[model samples]
Target: MGQLVRGVWTADADFPRDADGRFDRAASQFRDMHVEPVAGRYHLYVSLACPWAHRTLVARALLGLEHAIDVSIVEPVWQDNGWQFSDRYPDRLHGARYLWELYVRARADFTGRVTVPVLWDRERDTIVNNESAEILRLLHTAFAPLARTPRDLVPEPHRADIDAINARVYEAVNNGVYKCGFAGTQAAYDEAEAALFAALDELDATLAGRTWLVGDALTEADIRLFPTLVRFDAVYNIHFKCSRKRLVDYPNLLSHTVRMYRLPGVADTVDFDHIKRHYYLCHRSLNPRGIIPVTGQGAYLRLA
Candidate 1:
């Protein structure tokens, strides 16, 4: 949860909150940037545990952009120095031990939270875009010519519907869980928890008779929502105190999660061990003992 101030890493980082105790997530820096579609010119840095970063990973896989834009992964657990690169998952481009170093390298005085799903321009040696939503679109469009697959995640006809669904889901679901988990006051938690469940209830009903979120085929709307749903029962339900209902209780939503998991290359992007460890261990304030509760989540996610 640490952030950079004038390119210096501050140890005592606290999640920002409004006067009313509602968690206020700072916007990602490095927006309004562009990356060329040339193969091998771009690289992605991501954490498997992050839902936002996972969105880009799924897009990369679905579009068959693996051969074009390679990736470097940070260790699952975050530390005082923030996302670290261990011997197992070293930074391929630079030998930097921490992700913030990359941010500093990109801009000597960069001031903001150093988050992942960063699209690094290997040629320019700087970050092209750190926002996942923008990175997802880049993978879907800018890099489309280099993609081996013909899958259009954002179909032209379904653009409007997909955008509308993404807006609601992003606010009330994707970021809502964080608001619930990080809320500094009971009132804030109550408000966020209420919105999270309301959005889930609506989504469950939406998927009751439909296989996909928007069009006849899988779209970005489903991709954006899947990461949150996949992590809900295991992480958010308990870790975030969003225990009003487990994801499994919503039959349609659970079915949608399983269907997405069954997709080729999509399941491979999910590392349940990493996902569980990162949340349970990284957030020491939430679980001081760092004890990860066991659940039959793996059995639920399996295709068989």
Candidate 2:
């Protein structure tokens, strides 16, 4: 519910909510992203719990950029200090204790949300990009020369289609869950929940008899949606008040989700432990007691 006011980190302020009690997200501040792809030149900072960050990881795995672009994972929970590295994921790059340190390191006067899926240029010692959507595209093509198994997730023929679908899914589904969870009023929550479920219903219907969202191949559109879908029932359904329907209720959508997770390297990125703990414990406004739920999430991974 807080962010950096100036160059300094502060939790003294409140989340930016509209008059209608709807949560309005801040736009990403870092831009002008151009990276020179080379081994050990770039790194990724991500949280396994974050769906947006998860998108870039999917592209990295799908495109075979494991060797070209290295990554460091942060702990699932966000504290007053923001995302911090844990014993399991200690900083291997700059050895910063907190993710904000990297931001300040990137730009001393930087002001905005300290978000994950950051593309860091080690040579320049700055963040190349923090936008997951853009980073995903970059991972798809930027390191192609170094990729062990290159695949164009965003093909030219379906680029426009992918963009169009991304816009829709991002609004009503990917970011929709946040809108539902952060809504300040009952009316706001209701409106967000309705839009989210409607989108899910449409997606379920669209995915019927189809293996992919656009064209005959898996593209960025599917990549964009999978992270949200994979975590939908695990957290969104109960935690975000996005309970009008479970993903299991939408058979096609459920199958689509399972198929995506089963994709090579995709399942490795799915972490319900991080997903559940993050939503139920990190956001104090939502779950003040900070008690983690026993959602029996293991079966989710075993699904075909």
lDDT of 1 by residue, 1-304 (tens): 7888999998764678999999898898888456678989999999999999999999999889999999999999999999999999999988889999999999999998889988999888899899999999889888889999847888888888999999999999999999999999999999999999999999999998999999799999999999999999989999999999998899999999999988889989999899999999988889889999986778778643
What lDDT would candidate 2 get against the real structure? Answer: 0.84
Candidate 1 collision pairs: none
Q: Which ten residues in a row have the lowest lDDT in candidate 2?
A: 295-304
Backbone clashes, each candidate: 0, 0
- Candidate RMSDs in order: 1.1, 1.5
Model 2 residue runs over 4 Å out of place are: 12-14, 300-304
Candidate 1's displacement at residue 286, Å, is 0.8
TM-score of each: 0.98, 0.96
State the lDDT of candidate 2 residue by residue for 91-157, as single tens digits. Answer: 8899989898889988888788888988989888888888888888777777777777788887888
